[model samples]
Target: MAAQKNAGDKDTEEKKKEKVLRRPPEEEIIIRGGKGASIRRKEIGPESEVPSGTGKVAGGNAPANGEALAVHKEVAVKVDHLSMKFNLSQEKLDSLKEWFIKFLKRDIKYDEFWALKDINFTLYKGERLGILGLNGAGKSTLLKAIAGVYKPTEGSVYRKGVLAPLLELGAGFDMQYTARENIYLYGAVLGYSKEFIDSKFDEIIKFSELQKFIDVPLKNYSSGMKTRLGFAICTAVDPDILILDEVLSVGDAKFRKKSEKKITSMFSSDVTVLFVSHSLAQVRRICDKAMILDHGKLLAYGDVEEIADRYEEMTEK
Candidate 1:
């Protein structure tokens, strides 16, 4: 009996050793600087620069011991009881007259749909948070709410920095206008002055690789082209907080790689990022912390690796 117990203990020790061996090595983050364009590589540690306390829920759900609150050194984004309720029409009317008649008769009905419900979490300055979920999980809706594009039915979002949100492609562009004109228009929509846009105009175009088509109407551009232009313009501004929703996956493979590199370069500047992507591996690469949403409710939020593992399990099932 003693021999059997010793054998079981030996098996457990072997499994533990194997698990540690399977861990990947730490990666190096590249930092760029100077006119000479010198590059410096910093080893990324297992721990994040900013520690998200035990309260991984939205709105800083701190633990009773106050450990979570103590670790959150700087607050950048705070969501308080955030809930978005959309009144979806129960029936479709083919014509405006029909809708008006139904409305007048009090026959119209709407289904209350909550895209996000009492979501809570506090994001610290310089922390990258990856939001994970299946389709219709309200990831995009949460970003839109945080970006101030949608007003919540309950609670509020507090932000303490210049926010740059890249949500829908071609959102601020005028299809009738030229790409050059839309650059200015979209820049202005993002709260950049004409002078600021002027300074970054050439760089934006060069980065987008749209020099030849700059004068062409935006309506003539493809979805990927619009994504490139929007990404270039938004990233040029050096925003305090960057909001992204699946913009990285639209372009070709080469352009996608370039854009990923661009985003990686920005990490050294300590920009707070809220990213929603379908790629779990991408999330693990880009984010230190992550949150999981299901049916518009937050299920898990914490370290990226743990959340990614949990998300993978969910997808597999």
Candidate 2:
């Protein structure tokens, strides 16, 4: 009889054990479809662990030193002590001739610029992290590092899923080409195939609200016009990870709000967003977490409210 009682207790304990990041047996999986199929899941496991006092969390949920970091069974992006450096020449050499002459005499001089310094952070799947700093504060440099446009001088960044960066507006655009032609050109830069661009062509046109101006030469369009179209094209397709750098500031108030709505909708899916903006209000609205940087160093990293408060305090003083 005692043996039977012990077996019953063991069975109960075994039943209590569950899989990590899995819903309870009674919970149901929700699937939705439109452009693509999406599964709604209840976030379980160590993801709910609160951050440590300094914004770095420890314990079992914390990531290892160099592993494919998983904070709670899901990691969208991981940046490990990332840094970037550039060298600026002391003297201006207007032409190749001047540079060659300086090289022959061994008189080239440069000052090292550390654009970013030992910055470390992580973004879980479906998280929006806003980066805030004043001008010349390495905000854009950090975004460029994550986008793989500029190689890091030290440390590394690991990202899963397809990434779409709205870093430079119309980077590959041809001034002589028409708006319609530039779509194919910029689309290619964004990693979209010709067929995909063709299918989404009309959708992009309508969203930009530039149908009448679609066939006009890009050189003739105003800066705002170009911004509208570029924003429309980049946001048209859903990205697993999105990076935005000052792209929203060019548009008007109404258009900016429209773009915000589009970005806000991304939150419904498992999309990780990284952005740098001077507009603290916009960042606070779109991102739950914010990282404050000053002079190439991390000043604060925490909830948007905390970081924003810290930033305001610094700026005010």
**Strongest candidate by lDDT:** 1
* Per-model CA lDDT versus the true structure: 0.75, 0.71
Off by over 4 Å in 2: 1-70
Q: Note each model's CA RMSD in angstroms.
A: 17.4, 12.8
Tens digits of per-residue lDDT for model 2, 275-303? 88888888888887788888788777766
TM-score of each: 0.77, 0.77
- Candidate 2 collision pairs: none
Q: Model 1 off-target regions past 4 Å? A: 1-72, 93-96
